[model samples]
Target: MAGVAVAAIPDDIAETHKGIVQLFSSTDDQRSVRESGQAIAALDESTKARHLEMQQSIKELTGVTNRMLDELNDRKSNLLDPTTKRELLAQKSRAEDNIRRMQEDNASLQNQVGALSNKATDLTTSEQQIKQREINEVKRAKHTISLYANISSIKWDYSSPNVKGWITAGAASTGRMRAFEMERGSHSDFQVVNHLWNLMDSV
Candidate 1:
């Protein structure tokens, strides 16, 4: 027991305790450094993910731009000049207006054609009516001439000249309207042409 207590807590005891405290401080510092390294690695991973998202956004924007360019090219090919898209629009508007005017003109022409057809029909009807009246008049005169041939009569002296057109040689009155008689002499002043025309009209 004297040997054990003789050093009375030997000088190395304090030195040993100091060594242990330094060891624990060094271990805690190392653990802090390792956690900081892990946090830095995580930050690097997040940065890479954000960069990938930005690249995808750029790709989508480029696709939209390419589509717009293609549409512009298609419209450009249908025109004569590429520098005048507005001019092309104006020309298209003018063409539409001209088409509308042509349609109106076609309608007017159709109406005129219909009117002309109606006028032609009216003229034809009137001509037919006049022709029927003229035919009836001619028929009446023919009947008068036939009746005059059936009878022998003495007629008064005619005052008109040149009755030969209505009076034939040896003519006779065959009806009440007949005025000429059988007269072969050229000295007869015959004007039965007027009387025959009047009789035909009356008949």
Candidate 2:
């Protein structure tokens, strides 16, 4: 098949070109859409990475806050100088403020993650739909190719009585032969006529 030019017969060349162009053009469109989907997928990956980093940061901050609280509790329980007690209270206040800020940052990042998740889900659904459409288009294109490839091989079933008459009198001379054979009383002749009739009716 390499280097062979497959020229459609002149009779159908124009229509064939039109069909092929239309069919393949969608593939280009699908490729473009897929590129967009890939970008979105990349974004989703980055968003996930950022989410993980934020979660780790929040965990570390929580650990720091817990240790600071424990130290503050210990300081409160022990008898200490007034100056030391005030210093410990100040340290506790600062720790609580840092914990509050960390909690706020975590909440904000969680919201962002939620939004990103929704965006990712939407992109995934769109990508799937696009892929499905591409699949359907390819199937249709293949069917069109098969139809054209086997154009001469197409089974033209004549359903109209007029068309059936043509089959009996003209193209399908086998039907007329079957009619002639019917006089011999072989049931097979009847079957042949019936088969032809079925073919006619199947149109």
Candidate 3:
């Protein structure tokens, strides 16, 4: 037995198939994606605005050049004298120079904007680090307070040689008084206490 051949789909069926493929597409999803992209674009709106302004300026320069050419063409039709034609050409040359200067200024403005954006990012990072440090300091203070409260309940042996060091250690740990001896430049818990004592004594 021979197998039947397959036939090509008609144009109407193909068009209907294309419509069916898009039938399940969600407008809400497309709108959400577009809004997300626009939010990202808004973050760089300042830079985009500057670039747009520069582009507009270049467009204006082009317009000026075209107008000058049109004016020259009109003057040629009027059969103006050579002196007047020379003056118009000089004006055109000045307009060209202005365009070049505007382009250079645009480049400079872009560089300045980049520098400012970088500086802002650096400052933001620094601010966050400072805030984290402050939060850590507060947490440390609270921990010290809880530790002291628990340790104060204990009846320490003042007669024991090994336990005698607890006097200074306990004072430093509780943040009540500073330790007398320095411990290098480590800035550890005990070392900070020693530094505070040094500052007080110096004053």
Candidate 4:
């Protein structure tokens, strides 16, 4: 058996495969993925800190409100001065207002945290999809390479004495005489053409 000139893969396909490999294997893509993870971690930490701070503020305000209530209750049986009572009531109202404002701030903070969390989730999903696409492209490149390798590895028996007889028989059986002729015409090397003819005849 003799080897024939192998057809190379098309330029466009080769370029596409090269591009896919470069895009997935590049350091930039890796760095971007890492950055996304770091950003998510930072967001989580910020959210936790905000939550803890809000809780602490609410706790302190609640304590002050409770103290004022206790004082009001203690003075209820006594002849409390009107000014002192009004002052205590005003202080209580201010504390309650501060608590209400803090609660609203906490609610807004939670919404921001949720939005950041959703963004992180979307980033993660997009990264996974990109990885999947890279995997698929690699598979396609390998398959194309394998297919071309198989096509290029085809061998023919050019030196065999029975080649002509086999070709006639193959043509009669397969009705592919025209295809054989075209293949023969495509080759510049006479030996390669003979080998191809022999190979086709045997097929």
- The lDDT per prediction is 0.59, 0.58, 0.59, 0.60
Candidate achieving higher lDDT, 3 or 4: 4
lDDT of 2 by residue, 54-115 (tens): 66777778788889999998877764678777988999999999999999999999999999
* Clashes (N, CA, C under 3 Å) per candidate: 3, 0, 0, 1
TM-score of each: 0.38, 0.34, 0.37, 0.35
- Candidate 4 local lDDT, 1-203, one digit each (tens): 12223244569855865565566556568876566556655765686677667667777787888899888887884437787778888999999999999999999999999999999999999999999987886567446534533553332244543222223333236543322223322433445445554664465
lDDT string for model 1 (2-93, tens) is 11111133478547645655665577587755665566557656766776676677777878888999989977775656567788788999
lDDT leader: 4
Q: Against the hidden true structure, what lDDT does model 1 obtain?
A: 0.59
Instruction: State the lDDT of candidate 3 residue by residue for 1-203, as single tens digits.
Output: 12223344469855764554355344447665566556545744665676667667777787888899999998787667777778889999999999999999999999999999999999999999999997898579446634643654223343553211222334445444322333332345554444444444442
lDDT of 3 at 155: 30
Q: Model 4, residue 25: displacement in angstroms?
A: 99
lDDT of 3 at 189: 51
